[model samples]
Structures are given as structure tokens and as C-alpha cells.
Target chain A: MKAQKFWPWLIVTLGAAYFLIPLLATFIFSLRMRRNEYTFDAYVSVFSDPKFYATFGYSLSVGVFTIIVGIFVVVPAVYFVRLRMPWLRPFMEFVTLLPLVIPALVLVYGYVRLYGSSSLIPFTGSILGTDILLTCAYVMLAMPYMYRAVDNGMRTIDIGTLTEAAQIMGASQVQIIGNIILPNILVAILSGAFLTFAIVIGEFTIASLLNRPAFGPYLVGIGTNRAYEPAALAIISFIITWGAMGMINVLGRFAPRTSARTD
Target chain B: MPAFLEVQNLVKSFGTNTVVKGVNFAFAKGEFISLLGPSGCGKTTILRMIAGFERPTSGTIRVDGEDITHLKPNQRQLGMVFQAYALFPNMTVGENIAFGLKVAGMPAEQRRARVDEMLKLIGLLGFDKRYPYEMSGGQQQRVALARAIAPKPRLLLLDEPLSALDAKIRVSLREEIRAIQRDLGITTVFVTHDQEEAMSISDRIVVMNSGNIEQLGAAHDIYNRPATRFVATFVGQLNTLPAGVLAGTPGERAIRPELISLAPRPETDLTLTGTIADLHFLGSVQRLRVDIGGTLVNIDTFNNQTSPLQRGDTVTLHLAQKDLLTLGA
Candidate 1:
């Protein structure tokens, strides 16, 4: 009995150490920029660089844009499939999973080939068009996560009766979606949004191929020439991902609790 | 004058299967009627048609002389309480009750006052701020009721609203619902499969089977004078005896177990000899299965302080001639 309890705790401690050690090592390495002493020189050097602010800001804006486009595309498509065209659910699910099945590198390659400068819709012709193309690609890459989250959220509530009840109350279709459906699924949407933010912030393939100075390309550029500053950048990227996940956990508590109590 | 709610030649079919086969019924204003049937009997389908949730393949549903057959659910001005107590999880009790009023563009102050009135009507006066998750199922159902009726809809529909609750709460809440319906005097169409629930609350019970209404009458008439073999067997517990055994013409005879007695009495018109096959004590009454002439007949008698009859004992059972109902196949 003692061994049974001890084994689980030992395994959990080992797993925690396995994850935390890399982060700890990177943090200590980032502080060793000043010769023979620990200091915040690497962090200061990275923070003072104008490219750092420009690239990070660009990535943040792209992340937000990707989330907005993803919500507009996924929420209504999933909602309509669930409410009006339930027979098409399997097809929609299969489409969403295609992103996960087709890797990001291959997808970016297809975008380059199909939307090249000579194509009819030359999305890669101009820098602005390429950015838009990159944003669309990120939305596709995040499709599996976003769709599953919203679908699971929809499963918890009875969309049929809720829609009927709302209609009986004289709410228009837009009002029903805005006031009733959106609020009920806010947590799921936020969870998907945060996951998308984490995924797009340091994405490498599409942004690099598109020649955009996103944070992922910046981190790679630094890794080639600078040693301690790369470690500093890694620490910053880790914090951003950690912060997004933390926000999801905090906001999740506020979502409406399912009333399963029969007391 | 036209009836308040009239459904004419209502029919519904899904794919190749016909669920409701041209049902027709009407009710006056302020009438509490129940559509009672087993599952797949299309009772709920009929109720949904009336609520404008399901479009009837062929029918005309008129409310106060207005043809609402093709109207949308919002235009129907009908309220519905679902079997699952579908209270919106995001809203508080007061907000849920005020949803219809808010959507109708009622002013805020008036909406608040109306919501308070509905909350008081449902006996949840101080529960305006509580979310549905914090409340019990019975409480949530009351909130759902409040939310449905706050708009003062032209008609109210309850689809087995009490089927999910416990026995005690089901009984008490059903009575509360009946009392509220009486006080409001709103026309109501309730759907349920439980016969006792229908008999206890409805002014008229429409017993349906296989997409057709078997019988429609008051509780007493439906129970005492069932019009069909399906109605006789489905509405209550019944024992079927061969026509030859009852000395009747050439059809099956149906009799209620409670109508039979062990001892002969002045009102008794038919007598039979049988041996007791089994006895089941059911709190206030005892049910006995007797083998009479190779046929089994069940009889229910009040449980008295005297020692009960034992199994395998030969006994004489009595039944009035009027109690034996002859049914056609």
C-alpha cells in the first residue's frame, strides 16, 4: 500500500522535473550574458533591440487577426451544420481534421504553388496579400483545435430547444446568435482563441516562407549568431505561451455551470 | 363561434413513415387538455405542430380564427416548457424570465416588474439572482415555467414536464402546475405517457396510439367507458377474459382488477370460482391473481387488519355485469 502511493508521487515529481529543468536551464543561461557573472544583460539587449518590438508586435497582431477570422468561419459553420444540416456533420468533421492530417509545411507549399504571382487569385503577389494568406493558413492550422472546442461546448447545451425557446420569445436569428448562443459558448471560444494565440505566436513555416518578420523568424535569426540572447528569446516565448494558457484556465471558471443537481 | 384552438386533419410524415395520421381536435378557451400516450404515439409531434416547432405535412391550425399553420414559432405567441427543463445556463432566474419581454422590446422598468410578478407567481420571489446551476431540478423547472409564461402567451404547451422529477416532487409540482393553470386560466395542452398524471390534472384526456387518437373524454369517462381495446388496456390495468367465460356474445371482455371482489354482494351480478394463484401487498390495497377455469383474473381488495387469504385457496369472485366491458378486435 505504501509503495502504491509512493510510486505515483515519484512519477509525478519526475515528470515535473523533466519539464521544469529545461526552462530553468534556459533562464539561468539567459542571465549569463555579462562575463563571469549572472546579470539581465541578455534580456536588456533583446528588449532594447527595435526588431524585437516590431517582430513581436507583428506576431501579436497576426495572432489576433487569425483568431477573429477563425471565429467568423468556424462558429457559424459548426452551428449551421448542427442545427440545420445534421446529416453533413461527418463531412464537416472530416474537413476540419484535414488540417491536422496535412502538415503545415505541405500546406504552405500548396499555398505557394496555388496562389503564386501568376495564379488567378495571386495571394502571394504583394506583401499585404501574403500576410493575409499567412493569416488564412494559420486559421487552417488551428482549425482542429477551434472546431473541437466549439463543438464540445455545443454538445453541453440543447441547441434545438434553446433555439426554439429563444424564437418563441421573439428573438430574431441574429439576436438569438448574439445574445443567447454566443454567451453560452464564450468559454469554449476563448479557449480556442488562446490555443490559437499560442500556436500562431511562434509559428515558423508560413511566416518564414512569406518573408514576414514574425517572432518565430526573429528567434531563429538570433539563434544563428547570438547565444545568450536566443535563450532570452526562448524564455520570453515560453512566458507568452504560459500566459495564454493561464488566461484560458481563469476565464473557464466563469462559464455557465451545467445545472445537473437534483437536490 | 370557432374554438379557441382548433387543429383540422393534422398529418405528419417523416420519410416513408407516417407518424400522425390526420388527427383532429379542438378545445375551448381556458381548457386544460392532455395528450396521453406511449412513446412513438406522435402525441409530442402533435404538440410540437401546435407550437409551430414542427410543420404539419397537411393541416390547418387556427388560433382564435387566425390561421397560424405556417406562422413561425415566434409569431405563434405560444409558450413551451420542455421535458428537460431547458433553462438558459448563462442567465439568472430573473433574466431568463424577462427574456421574452426584453425581446418584445418592453421597457426595462416594466420588464423588471413583469419578471417580479412571474417570479412571485412561480413561488420563486427571492430567487431572481440565482443561476440555474445553483438550483435543484424542481426549482429549475419552476423557473422554466416562469420563463415560459412571463410573456402572457396565447397558449401554453408542456411536454412531459414532470417526467424527469422524483415521485414526490412530480406529484406536488404537478398539483402546483394545475393550480397555477387554474389561476391564470390560460389554455394549456400537456403531453405525457403517464395515465395517472393525465387523469389527475387534465379537464380532458386524449389517449393516442400509433399516430391516432384512440379515445378523447374526461378522466372518469375514459376510465369507466373505454371506447376501444387499445384504450381499455393502455389507460389502466385490465384483465382480458374470453367471451365464453363471461357468457357474453363473441368478443373479448375487459374488466378492471379493482372492480372485482372476493365475496358476493348485493350489486354483484357475475360470479366465478377460482383458486388464488398469488397475492401482492401494495400498501393500501392487495392484488390477488386467481385461476378461474384455466384463465387468470386479477382482483384488488382493500387491505384490512384481518389475516389475508393465502395462495392456493379456492375462492369465489364477484363482478357486476356493467363492469365487464366487451371489446372488439
Candidate 2:
């Protein structure tokens, strides 16, 4: 019994140390911007910088767009497939997973190849077109997580009976989707949104290649130009991503259990 | 009187397999009809067709002279309760009950009052704030019932609403559902595989087999005068005895276990000597399996015999001519 307990404790301690040590070192180094005596000058500098506000705000809005697009694209596809065309699941799963197997750089390059200048649809010709292209890319990138989260959340409740119940009671299509489907899967959607937000905020390749001033490229710009502020930015980025993950975890606990599944 | 709900020539086919083959039935207003059948008998398919969930391949469904066969489910003004767990888990009991009323654009005060009335009808008047997951299965089902009827829909459809609960709750909830239906005077169509539940709750039962309705009548008629052997075997316990037991006839006889008695009476039409094969004590009734030469027949009698009869004991089984069933093929 003691030996069994020892192995898990040792494994957890090692795992925690492996992840926490680098973040702790970066945090400690970030506090040393003022030399011999420790200070929060690095963090203060990152906070007060005008570039930080512009890039962070831009990234935040882009993340929101990506999430909205993801919802509009994924929810209906999943709902329709699960309810009406269930045989399409295996094919849809493979399509959703393509984002994971195909690297981000390859996807962006393919986008550039297909929609570059002198092409039929020159998306990269204008800044707005480029932003739209980037948002679409992010939607594709986050498909795996968003699809699974929505599907799992949907699994916990019987949507078919609920839809039928609502419909027979004089609820139209919009009312059924808005009042019945959305509320039931709200937790899953939020979880997926937060995850997509975290991914978008720190994403560098697409935003940089598209010449957009996203926070990821700004972080790289700072890292290459300065020393201590880079650590501060890294810590801040870690906090934001961790906060999103924390929200996902906390919201997951509130989703109704499947024991009362009605179908 | 014109039938309030009329189903004419209803047929549904899924791909190559035909489920409901041109079935037709109609009931008057305030009638409680149950579609009773075994699994895969197209009973639920017919109910879904009526509810507008499944489109009939042919024929039309009319309610009060309005043809609603092509109408969407929402436009049909029907209240439906599913088998189990159809209550919205995210909403409270009050919200669930008031959902239809809210959708219908009822003012807040009226919706709240109607919700409270439904809660009171279901004996859960004070449970407005309770979410579905916080309640038991039976309570949640009752909330679903309240939700379905709060809109005072034109017709109420129940698709095996009490099949998920335990035996005790299933019985009591069904009784409560029947009483509530009577109180509201709503025309209701229920679907269930439990014949006893249908017999007790429905004004008339439609006994279905394969993809067709084998018999449709009151429970007493369905049991005593079954239209077919499928109805006889499906509705109740039936024992087939050789005709030789009835003073040497050619064909077999179908009789219910309880119709045959151990004690002979003045009106007893036939008496057969048989050896007691097995005895089953079913609380108020004891079922006996008797062997009369090569034929075996089941006999049920009152459980008044304190002394247990041995398997080899000779006993005389009594039957009445009126109790013998005439079933079609």
C-alpha cells in the first residue's frame, strides 16, 4: 500500500516540478529588472507600454471573432449531423481532426498560396481581408477542441426529445435553438470559446505571416528587442492561458450529469 | 358527434421497410386512448406521426376538421411528454412548466399563475425553484407533465412517460397522470408496452403487432373477446389447452388462467381431472399448472388453501363456456 502510494506521489511531484520550475525561474528573473534588489519594474514596463495595449486588444478581438465563427460553423454542423445525419459522424470527425494533423504553418502557407496577391481572391491584398483569413484559419485550428466539447456536452442530455418537446409545445426553430439547445450546451460552448481564446491570444505564425499586429508577434518583437520584459510578458501570457483553462475546468463542473438523460 | 381527432389512411415507411401500413383510427374529444404494442410494432411510429415528428408516407391527420398532416410540430398546438428525462435540466421546475406559455407570448403574471396551477395539479405547488436534476426521476417526470400541459394544448401526447421509474412510482404516477387528464378534460394519446398500465388508464387500447393494429377496443373486450391470437397472447396471460380436455373436440382452446378455477360451481361448463404439476403462490392468487393426460393447462384460484397441494395430487379443474375465447388467426 505504501509502495503504491509512493509511485503516484513521486510521479505527480516530478510532473509539477517540470512545469512549475521554469515559470518560477522566469517570474523570479522578471522581478530582477531593477538589478541587485528585486523589483516589479519589468512587469510595470510591460503594463505601461502603449504597444502592449494595442496588440493585446487586437488579439482579444480576433479571438472573439474566431470563437463566434467557430460557434456558427461547428454547432449547427454537429447538431444537424447528430440528429439528422448520424452516419456522417465518422467522416465529420476525420474532417475536424485534419487541423491537428496538418501543421499551422502549412495551413497558413496553403492559405497564402490559394489567396495571395494576383490570385482570383486576393485575401492578402488588404489588411481587412488578411484579418478575415486569419480568423478563418483560427476557426479551423480550434475545430478539434470545439467539436469535442460541444459533442460531449450534448451527450449529457437528450437533445432529440427536448427538441420534440419544445416543438410540440409551439416553439419555432429559432426559439428551439435559442431557448433549448443553446442553454443546455452553454457550458460546453464557453469552455470551447475560452480554449479558442487562449489559442488565439498567443498564436504567432498566422498573425505574423499575415502582417497583423497580434499579441503573439508583439511578444516575439519584445523578446528579440529586450531582456527582462520578455520574461514579464511570458509570465503574463502564462497567466492569461492558465486563467482560460481554469475557467474551462470550473465551467465543466456545472454541466448537468447524464443520469437524468431522457431519450 | 364528429371525431375531434381523425387519423385517416396513415402510412409510414423507412427506406425499404414499411412500418405503419395504412392504419386509421379516430377518437372523440376528452378521450384517453393508449397505443399498446410490443417493441418494433410501429406503435411509437404512429404516435410520432401524430405529433408531427415523423411524417407519414401517405394519408392525412386531421384535428377538429383542420388537416395538420403537413404542419410543423410547433404549429400543431400539441403537448407531448417523452419517456423520461425530457425536462430541461438547466431550467427550474417553474420555468420548465411555463416554457410553452412563455413561447406563446403570455404575460409574466398569467404565465406564473398557470405554472403555479400546473404545479398544484401535480402536487408540487411549492417546487418552483427546483431544477430538474435536483429532483427524483418521478418528480422530474411530473414536472415534464406539468410543462407539457401548462400551455393547455389541443391534444396531449404521452410517449411511455412512466416507463423509466420503478414499479411503485410507475403505478402511482400513472394514476396521477390519469386523474390530471380527467381533471383537465384533455384528449390524450398515450403509448406504452405495458398492457396492465394501458388497461388501467386508457378508455380504449389499440393493441398493435408487427406494423398493424391487431385489435382496438376497451380493455375488457380486448381481453375477453380478442380479435386475434396475437392480441390474446399480447394483452394477458393465455393458456392453450388441447380440445380433448373439453370432452374431445378437434381444435385447441384459448383461456385465461384466472378464468379456470379449482373449485367446481353450479355454472361450471366443464370439469377435467388432472394431476397437479406445479403450484405458484402469487399473493392473492395461486396459479396451478395441471397435467390432464398429455395436455397441460394453467389454473388460477384464490389463495385460500393453507395446505400446499403436492405435485402428484389429483384435482379437478373447472371452466365456464362463456370464459372460452374465440381468437382469429
Candidate 3:
């Protein structure tokens, strides 16, 4: 019995170590100023650079903006398909998950063809060349995760009952969505928000393809410029992503415990 | 009071299956009516239709003579307690109770006052701040009831509200529900599969079978004079004996177990002489399975000063003619 349990855990531990080895090496490399001599020089130098700060701040703002837009677009769309037009569920789910199936770089290339200068979508000419394109691409990349999270959350409750309950109490559709449905699935939304942040913050494919001044491109640029500084930046990005996921997991634990009502 | 809520030929179907077929019933003001039946007999479906959760395939539903078949559940001002209680987990007990009123856009002060009133009414006055997960099943059901009633809806619909509870809790909460319904004098529609529950709490019982109303009337009439074979077997224990029209009616002379007497006394109108094949000795009553020719008849007798009969005993079973109901095709 002991061996049976230990074998699976040992394999998992080794699997975790395999994925984490480069991250550990990057952290150690960031800490060292010279051969095996530890110092905080790389971190201080990276923090002092305005370019690094700009990229970090830009990532945070883009993460927040992408999530807000995604929630506004996805929550009602998902709730509608789930509750009202159930016949369209499988189709809608397929469309939403299509983004995940296609490579992010391929979609970003398509975005450039559709919205770049002398492209089909003329309205793209009004916005700045890369920033708008980048934000829109980020929205596309985050669609599958955000939509599934909200959809799963909405599925856990009697959407009809909650809506009817709110309606009977004299709430409009907007109020029902905001007050009752959203509050109940707040945890799912939070998890989705963090997941979106992680994907956008460390996302390489779209940022590299678009050649935008985003965190991923900046990280790559730093990696080519100074070895230790790039390692420090990578560790910082890892910690940010880790922190977001950790907060999400803590709330996720309470979700099932409270899901009895939804049932 | 006249019928405050009237349903006319309400019908619903799914694909080829008709779950509720042309059900028409009405409830007077302050009446507690139970829609009782076995599983898949359309009891819950009827309740859902009334609550505006399910749209009828045909016919009309009217509350106070106004048609409401097209109106949404919330639009109809109907408060419903689902089988699972359907309490909001994230909200406090007070907030759950106050949800309807809050949706009604009542002022904070008025809603607070109404929540207090409801908490007292449901016997959970001190549990306002507690969430639904903190409470037991029975307690949660009570909160659901309190929430349904708090808004003072024009009608209350309870869909198998006590079915999830244990036996003891079921009885107590049922009584509590009936008491609250009585005190408030609200016209309430309750659905349940348990016949005893329907008989105990309802002023009228609508017994359904196979997507149709089998028999409906006062509980006494439904149990004592069941109109169909389905109802007879469904409502209570009944004993069947085959007799080729040695009788008045074709499906005549079927005796209920409770109405069967062991001895043929002067008051007995019908008598059957048979050999007891088996005997079951219950504390209060003895059930004797007797062989009458090729047919087996069951007779129930109350344990009074009478001695217990043996399995092989030959006896004459007596029954009142009035207790036997003749079913027709």
C-alpha cells in the first residue's frame, strides 16, 4: 500500500522538478553577479530601468482591460446560450474553443492581415497600429479560458430559477445579471480573471508575432540584451503568475463547499 | 371564498410523452391543495406549470380571473419552494428571505422589517445572519418557506418541499408549514408523492396517474372511495377478490384492508368463507391472507380483545358493503 501511494507521488514530484528545473536555474542565475558569487545587482538594475517598468505596468493594465472587456462580452453571451438558447450550446462552445485550437501566432497574423494598413477592416486605421491590434489579439487568446470559466460557473446554478427569483423581486435583467448571477459565480470569474492575466502576462506567441511593445516582447528583448537581467525579469513574471493562480486556488476551494445551493 | 386561482385544460408534453394532460383545477382563497401522485404521474409538472416554470402546450391559467399562462413566474407574483429548497448559498438567511422583496425594489428599512417578520414567522428569528450552508436540511427548507412567504406573494407553490427531510423532520416541518399557511391564509399549492402527507396537510387532494387526474376531492373521498384501480392501489392497501358477476356491478365488491372484519357479525353485509393461508401479526392489526377458492383475499382486523388466528384457521371474513368501491372502465 505504501509503495503504491509513493510511486505515483514520486513520479509527480519528478514531473514537477522536470518542468521547474529551468525556472530554478534562471532564479539562481539572476542572483549571481559573478561565478558562484550571489548578489541582487541584476534585480536592482532591472528595476531601475524605465523600459522594464513600462513593460511591467503595460502588462498589468492590458491584463486588467482585457479581462473587463472579456467579462462584459462573455458573461451574458454564455448565460444566454446556457439558459435560453440551449440548442446553440454545442455550437457556441465550439466557436469559443476555436481560439484555443488555432495557434495564437496564426491568429495574430490573421489580425494583421485584417486590420493592418490597406487591410479589409478599415476602422482599424483609426486606432494606433499595434496596441489596438495587440489588445484585440489578447482578447481572442483569452476567449476559451474566460468563456469556459463563466460557462462552467453558470452551469452550476439554476440560471432560470435565479433569474426568475430576481425578476419576481422586480429586478430587471441587468440587475439580475449584476446582483444575483454575477455575485454567485464571483469565484469562477475571479479564477478566469487570474487565468487571463497569467496567459497575457507570459504570452509569447502573439506578442512576438505582432512585434508589439508588450511584456512578452520586452522579456525577449531583455533576454537578448543582458543575460542576468532577463533571468530576473523572467523570475518576476513567474512570481506574478504564480501569485495570481495561488489566490484563485484558495477561493476555488470554497467554491464547491458553497456549490450545494447552486445544485 | 370562491376560487382565486383557476386552471383550465392546462396541458404540457415532451416529444411523444404527455406529462400533464388537460389538468383543470381551482383553489379558493386561503386553501391548501396538494397535488399528490406516484413518480412520473405529472404532479410536479402541474406545480411547475402553475409556478410559470413550465409553459403549457395548450389551455389557460388564471389567477383571480386574469389569464397568466404567458406571464413569467416572477411576473405572476407566485412564491415557490423547490424540492431541493433552492436557497441562495452566498446570501445570509435574512437576505435569502428578503430576496423577493429586495427585487420588488422595496426600501431598505421596509425590507429589513419584512425580513424580521418572516424570520419570526418561520421560527428562525435569530438565524438571520447565517448562510444556508450553515443550516440543516429541515432548517434550510424552513428558510426556503420563509423566503417564499416573505414577499407575501399572491400564491405559494411548494414542490415536494419536505421530501428531502428525514421522517421525523418531514412530519414536523409539514405541520409547521400547514400552520404557517393557515395563519397567513394564503392560497398554497403543494406537490408530493406521499399520500399520507397529502391527506394530513391538504384541504383537498388532487390524485394523478399517467398524466391525468385519477381522482380528486376531499382527502376522505379520495382514500375511501377511490375512482380508479390505480388510485385504489396507490392511495392505500386494498385487497382484491375475483367474483364473476355474482354481484351488482362488474368490478364490484373489492374490500379495503382496513374495512375488513375477521368475524361475520350481524352488522356485516358481505361474508366470505376461506382458509387462512398466511397470517401477519402486527401490533395493532392482524393481516390474514386467506384462500377463497382459487383466489387469495387479504383481511385486516384490529387487535382488541380478539385472539390471534393461526395460519391454517378457517374463517368467515366480513365487510361493510359501503366500504367497497366498484371501479369502471
lDDT of candidate 3 over A1-263, digit per residue (tens): 58779989999999999989998999999999667789989999988999877877887788888898889988999888877899998898799889879987678767777777787674346536566667777787889999989988987888776676566555678878887788888889999999999988877777677665678788888888787998888888788878998999898876733433323
Comparing chain B with the reference, what is the TM-score for each candidate?
0.96, 0.97, 0.92
**Candidate 1 local lDDT, B100-152, one digit each (tens):** 99998999999999999998888889999999999999999999998889999
Backbone clashes (count) for model 3: 2
What clash pairs does model 2 have? none
lDDT of 2 by residue, A99-200 (tens): 999989999999999999879999999989999999999999999999998988777778888888888989987788788888889999999999899889
For model 2, the superposed segments whose C-alpha errors exceed 4 Å read A1-6, A109-127, A258-263, B305-310
* DockQ category of candidate 2: medium
lDDT of candidate 1 at residue A260, scale 0 to 100: 58
Best by TM-score: 2
* Native-referenced DockQ of model 3: 0.39
Could you estimate the TM-score for every candidate? 0.93, 0.94, 0.91
- Taking chain A by itself, what TM-score does each prediction score? 0.95, 0.93, 0.88
Cα-based lDDT at residue B126, candidate 3 = 91
Structural similarity of chain A in candidate 2, as TM-score: 0.93
lDDT of each: 0.91, 0.90, 0.82
